[model samples]
Target: MDVTGKVAVVTGAGRGIGHGIAMKLAQNGAHVVVADIVEENAREIAREVESTGKTSMACFLDVTDRQSVESMGESVINQFGQIDILVNNAGVIGAAGWEKRETASEADWDITFLVNVKGIGTVTDTISPHMKERRYGKIVNIASVAARKGTATSTPYGASKAGVINFTQSTALELAPFNINVNAVCPGLLWTDMWERIAVRFRSKDDYPDELTPREVFDRFVKARTPLGREQTPEDIGNATVFLASDAAENITGQALNICGGYMMN
Candidate 1:
């Protein structure tokens, strides 16, 4: 999968899955723009990409803010000339402390939708026009397995990802005539701050094992539920993302590809 000279904008590229995706794209010869709300983290990741002898730039982006997203698109266009791929990886599971729907406040639901759902639309809307004019683009949205299976405790998070899947299909249909391919990547369990926070919530459950640590609980859950018997990695997600963004997956669009190691068959 060669993406030489392509320019890709990856939101939330400061850490975790987004960072991994940015690095993978850079390694594959794409000039990556690492966008994140945290300026320092974005800069650090951009530096890491540059260290690989690939071109990269850091942009301060708040995905929830439409203006900020638009600014990022404009900045990337100015710096890179054109945008060939857009990876919508910016998302949230809400704050770790509030897990259950009963305990989750209205603010929690609002923020979750704003960041995970609307944020994708915000960034894509800002950049897709460029692709449309050029008649070329690849968009990989970072959805979750939760989108397919609902969670008792994290209802809002699941709902938000579900919205991503639906949005991907709709966007793919609309963009297809222009030769833009839109797809979703559903990642399983990965050891990131998001999962670390989720582990904390699991440990609070009454049925949680007495001897197991939060991370142990996470590992155990993955081992039992996933047929692969292990946790997925950021690199795994990144590789899938790069493939989707590359010419290798040119014929694929509006599809949800799960990287959950058999946790989800669909």
Candidate 2:
């Protein structure tokens, strides 16, 4: 994958999978723009991008807010002159704590979809016009294996990711006419802050093994669910995102590629 000299904007690029994507894109020769809800984190990642000899700018962004999305989009254009690639990586899994007998509340579902699904639309609405004008762009949405199948434990998150995959395809078809490739990457398992929450939640279950700590809980699930018997990394997701954004994938769109170490097939 080659994105040399391209200007790329990554939402939630401060840490975790988004951080990995920004760094990888820079390493691959793209000038990266780090956009995150956390200003300090975004700035830190932007400095790292610059340290890599790639141009960068940090923007405070809340993807759910149209104004925030518009502001970040404008800043990137003003600083980099163009946005060749956009990674829709900002998302939420909703509030974490729930007893085994309990289920996700309506409010949790609302907030989850607001950030994961509507947020994508907000940011894309801000950037797609520029892409159409140039007739060139690459859009990658960060989805998850949860989209492929639903679990009662995280119905909100899974449903939101499923929306992401569907939205990815719809946007791909629409943007293809303008030579913009839109795709989604379904990351299986990564031990980010989000995963920490997941592990903690699992450990709190009444039936869950009492001997297993949060990390152990995570490890057990990884061993059982991952056919590769290894945990997925942020870099793994980054690699897939970079490829989908590269010229080599110019002809590839409307596809949701799983980067889960064979954790979820087809």
| Cα-lDDT of candidate 1 | 0.91
lDDT agreement with native, every candidate: 0.91, 0.90
Q: How many backbone clashes does candidate 1 have?
A: 0
TM-score of each: 0.97, 0.96
Off by over 4 Å in 1: 99-102
In model 1, which range of ten residues has the least summed lDDT?
95-104
Tens digits of lDDT, candidate 2, 63-136: 98898899888888888789999999998887544333257877778889999999999999899999999999
Superposed model 2: Cα runs more than 4 Å off:
96-101
RMSD of candidates 1 onward, in order: 1.4, 1.6
After the best TM-score superposition of candidate 2, give how far the Cα of residue 252 lies from its true spot, in angstroms: 0.6
Q: Return the lDDT, model 2, position 42.
A: 96
lDDT of 1 at 108: 77
